[model samples]
Target: MKNKKILLAVCGSVSFYKAYEIISLLKSEGADVRVMLSDGALRFANLISFEALVQNRVLSSISEDWQSGLNHINYSKNDLIIIAPASANTINKIAHGVADNVFLQTILASTCPKLIAPAANNNMLENFTTKNSLEILSKNGYDICEPVSKILACGDLGKGALADPQIIVEMAKRTLNQDNFYKGKKVVVTGGATTEKIDDVRGITNFSSGKMAKALADAFYYAGAELTFISSNEFSAPYPIIKFSSSEELLNAINSQNLSQNDLLVMCAAVSDYKPKTKFNGKMKKSQNELNLELVLNTDILKSLNLNCKKIGFKMEMDRALAKQNAINMLNSKNLNAVCLNVLDEKIKFGSDQTKIDFITPNGEFDTGFDTKPNIAQKITELAKQI
Candidate 1:
């Protein structure tokens, strides 16, 4: 990560102090570092401390230096932008393209890859509105360094804490170093089944173990693409994992990923098509009588995606001919570059280790034959490189 230009954008939060440590770490690693603070962040962060550690003046909302007028515009030339301890206000503003302050204005002007590490109270992290804002940021191609679950400044213990400076730096290094075909490529992968809530405890879902999604993510990572893996399953991987539970949540996850015209989106998740019209906050008591549940169409993620990227959709059907047609229709309807079709059968169980799939691209369809998930993933990775 040496010889790299990095801008450390600090936001208002108890975790503002972490920015100093990050600056120190990045500088020691031979990176040219600059610091900027938001209005709220200035209250918690001592600008002098950052200047002393980074050997440069800190830029803030009231900055009047020679470059103050064109700071945001000129700073767009930097290689990377990182928002440490990103406050709810800053995240919300940036997600919606609000550039009122120096920090946000600079971000809007820069076309470089941005990494965001959010810090706030547990309630704020869990808030539906805040969650949606974060999603929007992702869809705009911002890399979200999700907060970890920990005891925050408040007494409540949950997610809303800034990650360790060491971990943040490591992620930054990975983001900046891309030497393969996937170099600078933004690849978003969605996997697993989305659950529809009937009550607080019960819901409906599809059969998906997310094994194939994991395989595909690993392939993308090894190929050197900036990978964002969204899953409905619980597991650990080397890449950043964004997990969602419902169809709406999955849509938000997909929408939030930072995808560019050169990026690739692989839609492999088994999302629900419908959900209960009304859901009880608390568990409903079981009665002896027959109960009918009202269902509504869930948002179609593929239809909702608005990013300019190479898109691949997945379709599964029992009949081979129907599956081919389904894949072609999905490809044409969504303006996707390719579609992966699977013929389901007794041997191809939900969690099966092997299955047959076809790659239906604009050039035509190519069958991979019956193969293991890993093998299929490798094939998919190669196909992605071609497009």
Candidate 2:
């Protein structure tokens, strides 16, 4: 652990005092630690405290003198970067690529893994703006540690407490070790909502956050797989990813690749089923509120791959009764080794961190209760090993 360099960014919150404890914990674990504090964070906890705890310079702004030319670039060069007690404003800034401050600048410059433990008022954390920002950050490959429900500093009881220091430290360690699993084998993951274009600027799409696909890719990487992630526009993956925007583009990407029988293909993309029959050369002019549009069915990429190679497919459904039956039918029809079935009714299918899935095979079905997407991917990979 001592060989692992960790850059800790402290943000403003009543829980900012706990940041010192985190520093001490990480140091005890023998991790090389550097500390950066946000301007608002310094109000709750002074820079002197962090310097004493980590025995390193505490950076607060870009103007701070350092041995390196740009502290942000230097700070970004670490194995892992974590922001504990992340304020709503801080998260927003990071999501938007705002580099006005040292913390945001370092985050923007960072290629290393990032983890954010939010610590703010429950209302603030739950606000639509904050949630959207977090979604964007997660889609961009940031690990979010959800705050615990506890008594607030303002005397309110709800979810907004910083996660336990131990939990945060362990998560950081796991993230750093993610590369160890990808030593061999080939893995492929598809992500994002593939557009079935209706016109020059319009199309049909689904609400695929690409989190599940990203998680699957991350898991395969950690499980010793040479990873090739094919995604649309979503970008929450922390690996070399290939991008595509349409169903045809995705199909072409898959078909053009030289895939082997030993390779594992996880079809997690929510591709559109149909496209417009007539594509306008330019943006369609607005006339009547109601207009008829001719549609054509898009190629089923997963089904096509299923016929030629062994693959894992995903089925997102709302009805439980239909899910198992549909999963089994799809598995057999598509010649899949296994299918992961999930329900969108509980909001587990998209735009959320936690999810529940049922793993289905021809012989039996296994219920994997609600869990983090990473853990679910782990379970899926383990199950794949059995087959």
Candidate 3:
């Protein structure tokens, strides 16, 4: 990690003082640190103090040194850039690509992964515009370190305080170590089943409990990827989650973002393959005799994600031959990196806590015998590292 360079950008916020502690903590962890401050940041902290602490010059503006032709581009080349106490205004600028200041300019020019810790007044943080901007930034692959809820300097008690410096340092360390194999990668995981609404509350869905998807998300997160867990309303993960209720909604959410080469899309959702052709305005009444429901094909999430980004799909089969064939077919048909095949005969899938999986990649196939979800997740992360 010492070989990796880190750029710490400070913005104008009462939490600016905490940024100093962050710099020292990162330096202690063997990272080469450089400091960049927004013009407003200097009001709270002095450049001299930053320089003395990092033993490097504090960069404030493009005009600070004409000898350096483009400071923003040079600073942007670091391995990981973090903006501690990122003001609401600065966060908005970053989301919209408004490079009005040196900090924003460097962020715009940066190709490395970014982590932002936003600190603002409670009202500003909860504002609709700020919320939308944060969503945009998240979709664009930014790791948002959630702020803590505490008494604000403005005499309000709510969210918007900078997270603990220790947490910030840990996140920065993870982001700096690209050789750790999965650092800074964005992974979109689809989990659970989409509910096709029949009425205001009634719907048709599946039995998928999203356990596999949640496992995958947790594994990917531990592997250092900025994960987006896209799931149906029935599924929930212990990490950052994005929920959807229908196939159309899930499709729209996936299509709304621009995924790059480094991004990995995991289509683990057991989406409903069929849905009612027509939804009823009210709940269907009890049937007197045998009733038939017409079903229509729902959107194929795996195929769509395959077209969008590098994808990993899952197939559950009852027969070994069919499982292998389906895995190979998915690899060829969808151009996936790999397919995780599960045989349902073991009864260790779906809502089960344990699973046995056969991994079929472009190079070969391997099986991980009945194991706990955590172990399965570890194996998946290992495979991802190889990729």
Best by lDDT: 1
Which regions of candidate 2 are displaced past 4 Å? 1-182, 236-238, 306-309, 347-349
lDDT of 2 at 114: 88
The regions of model 1 sitting more than 4 angstroms off are: 1-179
Task: List per-prediction Cα lDDT, in the order shown.
Answer: 0.83, 0.81, 0.80
Local accuracy of candidate 3 as per-residue lDDT tens digits, 1-387: 465698899999998999889988888878889999998898887888988998877788734564764377778888888999899999888888898777788889999988889999978988998999999998997878889899999999999899988878766654543335666678888888888987667788878888888888767775777778888745333346778889888888887656787688878877777888888777777767876778888877666652456778888777776778877987888778888888886567568989988888888977888898767976887776555
Clashes in model 2: which pairs? Answer: 139-236, 181-222, 181-224, 182-224
lDDT at position 107, candidate 3 = 89
Q: Taking the candidates one at a time, how many backbone clashes does each contain? A: 6, 4, 0
Q: How many backbone clashes does candidate 1 have?
A: 6
Question: Quick one: ranking by lDDT, best first?
Answer: 1, 2, 3
Cα lDDT tens digits for candidate 1, 178-282: 446887788999899989999999998988889888888867865668788999998666578998998888888888777888899999999888889999889
User: Which candidate tops TM-score?
Assistant: 3
Off by over 4 Å in 3: 1-145, 150-155, 158-179, 233-239, 287-290, 305-308
